[model samples]
Target: MDTARENRTWGALSDLPGHPMMWVLILTETVTFGLLFAIFAITGVVHSDVFSAGRAQLDPVLGGVNTLVLITSGWLAALAVEARVIGRRTIARLLLAGAAALGCVFTAIKVVEYATKVSVGIGLETDTFFTLYFLATGFHLLHVILGVIIIAAVAMYDSLDNLKTGTAFWHMVDLVWVVMYPLIYLVG
Candidate 1:
């Protein structure tokens, strides 16, 4: 309790959704991804032709579909948090489980995209664009996988702090993808 109170000196971050520690993780990760994203954008501007050529090989429609999937999952996660707040354990659990299921769906689609890339001889080593594509998306995918585990653990545990923290992390995952889709797919 004292530690949590001490953390509150930082202001909104201490009071933000989820555990204080979770907020710290979220902030750290946000900065990390922000830097990576900026680098990607800068690289694109420097090597416009290569970036455009790489973007041309990607399927924007698939990225769009994944965006929708992630948004829906984030919504479900929000609902889970709401339900937990209202003393509806069963509903919260169901919603968290559903959110995790949607994460799985996102992973499945990514796997298919990767397999397609492999079949077409496109890989991280293929080109600069492909390398950046794999690095950014692959890193995000790791977060999605971690979020699933966190969500599932929170569901079974049914602790308010854990629920809030886990769902917040999941939302972060969703957010990164939302930004990534436009950069890696739509921007060209």
Candidate 2:
């Protein structure tokens, strides 16, 4: 009975999308971000005034634009995976390029957002809200940069499995940002 259960577990894992290891990364990242999000929420309630002021300072328009950019990038990444599965290597590469380009745009917008904050002297020490804001968004920005690099590498390599794995990472990055935008930008 134990052997049967073990085999069932392994079989379920094997049927997951992308590389099994990539799912591991997705699960790990999701848990980490979830913890940060909960902390941010609890801290917001504890320091409601600080969080409100911090949210007011942020540019929701820019955050909305970034959200759209990431969503579209995720779509392109998905398309690239589909194209790869269909043996359309060139199309898949093009799709990946589009995805990576959007990733670059997202990164650029985030840098601009950070620069705007810094120009006004709003560093991480500004308050509890700013501290969590910088830490969470900065960590997410790092993932975007890494996702772009991985997408480019996958495009060059152009294997179906590699494309699926790399795009899966990209989608994970996108998912984080989608959840984060409203929480960090609009929640009050």
Candidate 3:
């Protein structure tokens, strides 16, 4: 009887499938972001005034909009995961598409912001603060682009099983943006 129960549990687990490797990928990404936060903290301590002044140059409107976009995408991703769990495949796909489109919008806005900064003579080589700002924001943008691509691919393939994992990653991205948006754009 115990053997039969164990078999049943294994079977159930197998039936509910998502990529096992996603957990490891997410953990590694979390560690990477943690290290980045640590570096930002250290830099802020050493160059508080410069960082503050540099932060002032950033356009708060753009940053806020980007933050909203990321947050909205995260919400959509969560909805997609929920829809998949409830067996609402069409809703799941629609939510995933919305998330992906929002991600694209986020990227476009970031590009515009970057272009404006460059035109105004603020870039990585401009100053320490700009360097840190570009490094942090640029890295985050890359992650956003990659996440969009991944979500688009999954949607194209009609695979909602991994929506939960994607949503988890999207939430992390949104959370990071929340912290970063205020730090880089609002606080003086």
Clashing pairs in 1: none
Residue 119, candidate 2: alpha-carbon lDDT: 100
What C-alpha lDDT, on a 0 to 100 scale, does residue 46 get in candidate 1?
Answer: 92
Better of 2 and 3 by TM-score: 2
Q: Estimate each model's TM-score.
A: 0.94, 0.94, 0.85
Largest lDDT belongs to which candidate? 2
Once all C-alphas are superposed, what RMSD does model 3 give against the true structure?
A: 4.0
For candidate 1, the per-residue lDDT at 60 reads 91
* lDDT (Cα, tens digit) per residue for candidate 3, span 89-125: 8888999999999999999999999999999888898
CA lDDT, candidate 2, residue 134 = 99
* Candidate order by decreasing TM-score: 1, 2, 3
Q: Model 1, which residues run further than 4 Å from truth? A: 1-12
What is residue 89's positional error in candidate 3, in angstroms? 1.4
For residues 1-188, what per-residue lDDT tens digits would candidate 2 score against the true structure? 79767556656556777787888888899999999999999999999998999999999999999999999999999998989898989999999999999999999999999999999999999999999999999999999999999999999988888998899899999999999999999977
Task: Kindly give the stretch of ten consecutive residues in candidate 1 with the minimal lDDT sum.
Answer: 6-15
Itemize residue pairs with steric clashes in candidate 2: none
Name the lDDT of candidate 1.
Answer: 0.92
Candidate 1, residue 87: lDDT:
95
For model 3, the stretches where C-alpha displacement exceeds 4 angstroms are 1-18
